[model samples]
Every structure is written in C-alpha cells, then in structure tokens.
Target: MAEMSYRTALVTGATSGLGRGLALWLARRGLRVFAAGRRVSQLQALAAEAQAAGATVEPVELDVTATDATLERIRALDGECGGLDLVVANAGVGGVTHAKRLQWERVKAIIDTNVTGAAATLSAVLPQMVERRRGHVVGVSSLAAFRGLAGHGAYSASKAFLATFMESLRVDLSGTGVRVTCIYPGFVKSELTEKNNFPMPFLMETEAAVDRMGNGILRGEGELYFPWQLALPSRLLKVVPNPLFDAAARRFR
Candidate 1:
C-alpha cells in the first residue's frame, strides 16, 4: 500500500481516548486536521496543542449521535475544508448490560452512536469523496466484534456492523480511488474500557493503538487488527466449531 499524508484528515470523537490520540497523531504528521468531539472545553485544549504543533486545526463541536446537528456541522466543515482526503468514523459507544434487559432507549442510544452515527458520517462524506474521486474512510471496530461477549451484547453487535459495513463500502467504492479501512483494536485502556469488570488479555497501551491506527490509515490498509494475540485468535474463531469455541471461551471468562 502507498503511504498517504495526513494533510486532510477528519477524526471523530476527539475529546478523549482513541479519537483524541488519533487527532493529535495526525496533526503531528502535519495534517490539516478537523478535530471533532462534544466537549467545548476539551476541544479548546486540543486546539491549543495543535496550534503549538504547527498544525492547522479546526476543532468542531459534534455529537455524532445527534441527527440534525451532526449533519449540519459536517456541512459546515465541508465548506470550510473545500475538500476532504480522509474521514475516520471513529465515534463509538460501549455498554455493560444484559441483552434480555437491554433498555430500548439505551440500546437505541448505543446503536445510534456506534452504528447509525458511523453510517451517517460516512454517507454524508462519501458523495463528496466520490465526486472528487479521492479520499480515504475508516471505521474503528473492536476485537469484541469477533464474537459475542456477555455484557457487551449491544456494543459488540454495533462493532460487528461496522466491520461488515466497511466490507460492503469497499466494494461500493471499488474503482473510485477512495480507500476504506476497518480497524479492529483490542484492549486499549480508555474511559470506555475502564468500566469493564473482567481482565483484558494482551491489553495494549492507548498510544500504541493510536499509532497503529495512524499507520494503517496512512498506508490505506483494508483491514487492520492490532495486538496480534487478539487478531490471531479472532481469526481462529471463524473456523473453530461453535461448541468447542464456546466451551473454551467460557473458560477464559
């Protein structure tokens, strides 16, 4: 894969965790970055840092889950940037709840942020990218998407949707010169993961995950799996018999 510069990358959920890390990493790459998130104060801090680093930073307030507002901000940015070279649909949500007791409202919230929000963000940007015949798009998935987990039923399903969505999108843009990458990162310590009650094996540092994402985006890798331990096993799950895999997975739990 050829390396692409981070000169025109738009990253979502930049207030914290992987989004923040990715925005900063891209800025360090001398990319004209549109750092998007919900927190006004945090975006301000990020702006200061990006400016100090000599990056043209546009900190836009965005709640990807919100329908009208999300699109409005995106439109505003599109006009401001003139054109976009990259869009990382990286906003996501994680929840600890039983599937049976999953509150309809809460589940919708999770779905809206992880699945609908992602789809909306990409859909909004895609026409522009296609019209220009350029741009790279990525969605941040999770190792949890590999298989169902006990408490993360909704979150896992949403991630799985992202993985599948990217596959479908790659086909849709096959000849458009637009690259689509689906990123699955495992056990990165973040506010989202801090609520987990169980142990995370081969857990990687957030910075490492961020770095991995930057490299993958720059190289235009189709599918990225980090922390080889998780990736290797996740691949095996596809071939392992349901009964045997369930038994082993339960033991690990």
Candidate 2:
C-alpha cells in the first residue's frame, strides 16, 4: 500500500479515548484537524493541547446523534478548510444491560447513535470526497460485531451494522478514489471499557490502539482488527455454532 498523505481531517467523539487520540495524532502529523464532540470544554482542552504541541486543532462542538446539525457543521467545516482529506466516524455509546433489563429508550439511543448517526456522518462527507476524488473514511467498529454478546446485544448489533455498512460502502465507492476503512478494535482502555465488569483479555492502552488504527487507516486498509490475541478469537467465534458460541459468550455476561 502506498503511504497516504493527509492535509486536513475531522474526527468525531474527539473529547476522549480513540477519537481524541486520533485527532491529536493527525494534528501532530501536520494535518489541520477539526476535533468534534458534544462537550465544549473537552474539545477546547483538546485544541489547546494540540496547539501546545505545535499543531493546529479546531474544536467543533457536535453531537453525531443530531444528524442534520452534524451535517451542517461538517459542511461548514469543509468550506472553511477548503476540503477534508479524512473523516473518522468514531463517536459511539454502549450499555452492559441484559436484554430483559434493556429499556426501549436505551436501545433506540444505541441504534440511533451507532447506526443512524454513523450513516449521517458518512452521508455528509462522502459526497464531498467523491467530488474531490481524494479522501478517506474510517468507521470505528468493534470486535463485538462478530457476534452478539448476551448482555451487549444492542452495542454488538450496532457495530455489526457499521462493519457491514462500511464494507458495502467500500464497494460502492470503488474506483472513486475514496478509501473506506472499518476498524474492529478489541478491548481498549477507554471511558467506555472502564465500565466493563468482566475480565477483558488483550486490553490495549488508548495510545497503542490509536497508533495501530492510525497506521491501518494511513495504509487505506479495507478492514482492521488489532491485538491478534483477541482478534483471532473474535473471528473464530464468528464461525462457531450458535449454541456453542452462546454458551461460551454467556460466561462474559
């Protein structure tokens, strides 16, 4: 794969974790970055940190769940930046509740943010990428997408949707000079994973995870899964018989 050079980028969920890490990493690579998230203070803090590092980062308060507003902000940012070389759809939420305890509102929120919001993010940026004939789109999925965990049905299903969506999109954009990458990360230290009660095998630090993902994205890899220790098992689980898989996965619940 040829080395990909980026001049400008936007990363959603930039307040913390992988998104924040990617935003800073890209900015440090000499890309002007738009760090987007729901929290103004956190975004500002990220921008300040980037500036202190001699990088350019602009904080953009955005809620990916708000589709129209998010699109408007992206368009405005694109106009301001001349064009975007990359867009990372990384905002996500998850819950550890059992199906019986999973409220309707919670399910809706997960689907809306993870599925609908991701689609909206792509919809807003892809047209511009196609027009420019140069851009990369990164979808931050999860290993959970390979199978639906007992207590993480909504979250897993959402990631499944995203992985499939990005795959389909990659085909749709073939020969368009627009790269699409879907990343299925295993357990990584982050605000989201901090809530998990079960033992997380092959857990990686946020910085290491970001580095791996960044490298994959730069290479324009169609799909990426890290820490082979966890990724191999997740892929194996995809082929296991449902009954056996359920029995094994239930232990995690």
Highest lDDT: which candidate?
2
Candidate 2, superposed: residue stretches over 4 Å from native = 1-3
Per-residue error (Å), model 2, residue 151: 0.6
> All models: lDDT?
0.85, 0.91
Model 1: lDDT of residue 139: 94
Which parts of model 1 have CA positions greater than 4 angstroms off?
A: 1-6
- Which digits, one per residue and each the tens of the lDDT, describe model 2 over residues 1-253? 4455799999998999999999999899899999999999999999999999999999998998999998998988888889899999999999864777878888889998899888888889899899988899999999999999888889999999999999999999988889999999999999999988888898999999999988888888999998899999899988899889878877766
The model with the greatest TM-score is: 2
Looking at model 2, which ten-residue stretch has the lowest summed lDDT? 1-10
Give per-residue CA lDDT, model 1, range 1-253, as digits (tens).
Answer: 3555545878898988999999988888788888888897898899898888887677888889886778777766776878778899998878775766777777788899999999888877788888877889999998888888766778889999999999999999988878999999998988888878888888889999999999888888999998998899887787888898779767865
Q: Give candidates' CA RMSD values in order.
A: 1.6, 1.1
